[model samples]
Target: MPEDLTRTARAEGQPLSETDNVEDMYLTFALGGEDYGVGIGGVTEIVGMQRIMGVPDVPAWIKGVINLRGKVIPLVDVRLRFGMAERAYDDRTVIIVLEVAAAPVGLIVDGVSEVLDIPPAQIDRPGQFGRSRSPVMGLARVGDRVTILLDAEVLVADGDLALPAELEA
Candidate 1:
């Protein structure tokens, strides 16, 4: 458990100290065959795929809710969130639990890669897309691979939260 926590912390890019040049660490994952990453600090845990109860009146991307240790956490499919076609959840599917705005939410990703330490020198600002909002934090180059880093806070905006009112209570 401690190791898992350590990995999670590293993935979230928790600053080591005041003098550490490593800007942040990211928890990389896959979605629609493309690599993406999120700050490790945002991730609470990574759990195997489970039953997700559907909710009405919410965006299609917002899959539904899951009973995680008696807490009802809303689930959002990363692929659908990015307008990618829905694919069957296989053995690799995992739900990444995150605390966004103090609320626990689940993000379904194709699979988790590994935690990477990305410094500022390796990150580049995202290019502007006309009339569209982006959830990207920055583009990180790790070795020969590029990972699209995401901002959890921006990804789950207050307006995007459509969990049933009862669950919010």
Candidate 2:
């Protein structure tokens, strides 16, 4: 998330698009050298480092759930989700609470960078924005990092989205 993103809708995100929207904000985080982003719309909160209980029989990417107040939200390691090497948690670790298709999930990130507002002009087609694994609609340059503006619905809940088998309905 950049310093400019709003907790609710922005004036720009209101407009419709033929495919991807022009007005959107992305919350940026780090996973090793690659910096990734999620839609600011889906973000509920950016919390400080917390304890995440480990559960057996879950995918490596699924770091398990946490007690967020009274709500139990599943935690996903963004690095592992991207098929990257796993690392120990530290002070910089953050849980980005997000809503995807109405389901709340917490993404474990290296750190919460900032909230950014990216106008449609900065965005490119999905192919140009991302690679084969994730389809992104836009890009935002934050400092030395280039964060991919994610389409939350697709990014968070893929058909073969590496979800824990038990989560299947």
Best by lDDT: 1
For model 1, the superposed segments whose C-alpha errors exceed 4 Å read 1-23
| lDDT for each residue of candidate 2 in 97-121, tens digit (9 for 90 to 100) | 9887677788888887655555555
C-alpha lDDT of all candidate models, in order: 0.78, 0.66
Per-prediction backbone clash count: 5, 7
CA error at residue 21 for candidate 2, angstroms: 11
Candidate 2 segments whose C-alpha is farther than 4 A from its true place: 1-23, 128-135, 141-145, 158-169
User: How well is each residue in 1-169 modelled by candidate 1, as lDDT tens digits?
Assistant: 1234223232354534445333376778998878898887778899999988888888888888889888898888888888899999999999999999888988899998876667777899887545265788788876677789988877766236755577766
TM-score versus the correct structure, for each prediction: 0.83, 0.71
**Lowest summed lDDT over 10 consecutive residues: which window, candidate 2?**
1-10
What is the C-alpha local distance difference test score of candidate 1?
0.78
TM-score of 2: 0.71
TM-score of 1: 0.83
